[model samples]
Target: MKIDDNFYMKLAIDEAWKFQLLTYPNPAVGCVVVKAGKLLAIEAHKEAGLSHAEVNALKTAFLTQEPNSLLKVLEKSSEIHDFLIKNHNGFFEDCEIYTTLEPCNHHGKTPSCAKLLSILKPKRLIIGLIDTNKIASGGIKTLESENIDVTTKVLEKECENLLLPFKSWQNKTSIFFKMAQTLNGSIDGQISSQRAKLYVHTLRDKIDLLMIGGNSVRVDKPILDTRYVKGREPDVFIYSKNKAFSQAIPLFKVPNRKVIISDDLFKLLDYKFVMVEGVYTLLDILKDKLDFVVLIISPKIRNGVNSVNELNIDFEILHENYLGDEKIVFLKRRA
Candidate 1:
């Protein structure tokens, strides 16, 4: 069946949600397959190095057909494309493939997904999104050459959501940072207990990763978990140059949290998934080669040292909220 723009939009939004699955250390990817007016399969890239969205969805569909069948699916499945070799029907005779991003065309760690799609020759290719990278881009162009029906732009906003990270990574940029502060521009005062815990929890839930310096961790000893939020939890990344924290620390007790130690401190800790958080130990990450977005929750009241100034980088105010005498200022690094 021919897929409509509305269908594409739904696919796009679903794809965006998939990208969110990879928090902190992973990239999100989501996919869905529909055939004969029934949702055949749905899957998302749950972890790094696992099969991608397309592969996972296809596998699920095949498994549902034969619960105990385990025929080398991806490799053998390539033959299904023969059905589309001619307009008459080789594969995808009446099937529809819907994905959040463009099908991959390159043969990287795995075979080219684009090539596999070409073989399946689905009745129609509905792309909710397009790949933005120079190398992996242009799956639509490749498929069009073979005369298979294709449609796009159904859920552009949703598709764009899934592509946000790749676009940011390819552009060598980060998301605009935001923060809340008091009327006087203070996140805290003489005592660290100034800002409301509810506001801090809100900030933690929206971010894919939460970052802080050794000083922040030492001073606040934050729990850094997102139990209060409705969504998945983000990974907590602590930047430290020395062995100031230990496994006995409360943060380390969390199941999936990671602490990035500097080379100077690597010998002191033996932990998996641990790496350097920023380019310099004491320097702010905004000043380094790593361009991931950061959101700082601070007070506008400058009664204490300014965290932005202490990092030694220029930042712009993105948002502001006032609570009585306190002012919350959201700031972002200049591109």
Candidate 2:
């Protein structure tokens, strides 16, 4: 099968989606390195203050070309970048690089990716979306100046969609609703696969706060932490008019986590990234304020009460993929 630029770019986009929202305060990004139409490395930015997608891809590519090189064991972004710059040995000189976002031109936590690419002298650089950030926007120009063949806007819309959460949080609070339902649309019981549930746990690990209806807390009596992923626990905000609840609720008992109970929704605005896990009641109330919705739909159909009949809403599907037998969808409310 002959692979085109779109094929590689799409792969990069999908790889980035795996780490979506997990890279809070940092745009989730993916990169692919291809030399002579042979596969090399596909990597994504996994977290804030970590090696970027480009660096990770290039490092992996270098190792593929020079297996015995001393690139291993270097975990920090700066360390990997420095090692690659010193020992690249023209490994990427004939390669084509695909990235979902433009390389950063300005140095922040990590060194300038554009500067490194210029030195590595990759034959061509394909970008899905230009960096909208003022500080990082000059990468294309930098690459062009270095005479590295550059292509832009490969799968532009899909790449742009990937950045929605990052952009929303940069300007204001980004509140996305998350819920799981069966094929029949029933919201009751556990509807997500273990993989789907793990995804939710990873999101919870990255978010600044997790909001849910007070009724959910009281009834489920759940331990709403990232225990499955062994990740950081997010603070919880319980939205309810009646703040009177038994102290025995599992969520309220989690150590080192603040469980805020209030009727005010404005408190959600205080956090940059917030995930709301609830059904019709909370969704209806938060419809106007939500930036997106994450639906985990199980493959099974059964007789049970569903949220579909409790509220009427239309959302445009932004992205969808499978987690085992479940179909996870990202949607935006239609205007």
**In TM-score terms, which candidate is top?**
2
- Candidate 1 lDDT tens digits, 245-335: 8566566676665555443323322322221222223344434433333233333446644444546566554333443344444333456
Could you give the C-alpha RMSD of every candidate to the true structure, in order shown?
9.8, 1.7
| Model 1 segments more than 4 A misplaced | 1-12, 15-27, 71-91, 171-210, 213-215, 221-335
Instruction: Give the Å shift of residue 236 in candidate 2.
Output: 1.6
Per-model TM values vs. the true structure: 0.53, 0.94
Score candidate 2 by TM-score against the native. 0.94
Model 1, backbone clash pairs (residues 3+ apart or across chains), number: 32
What overall lDDT, based on C-alpha atoms, would model 1 receive against the true structure?
Answer: 0.53
lDDT (C-alpha, whole model) for all candidates: 0.53, 0.89
lDDT of 2: 0.89
Looking at candidate 1, what is the lDDT of residue 68? Answer: 57
Question: How many steric overlaps are in each model, in order?
Answer: 32, 0
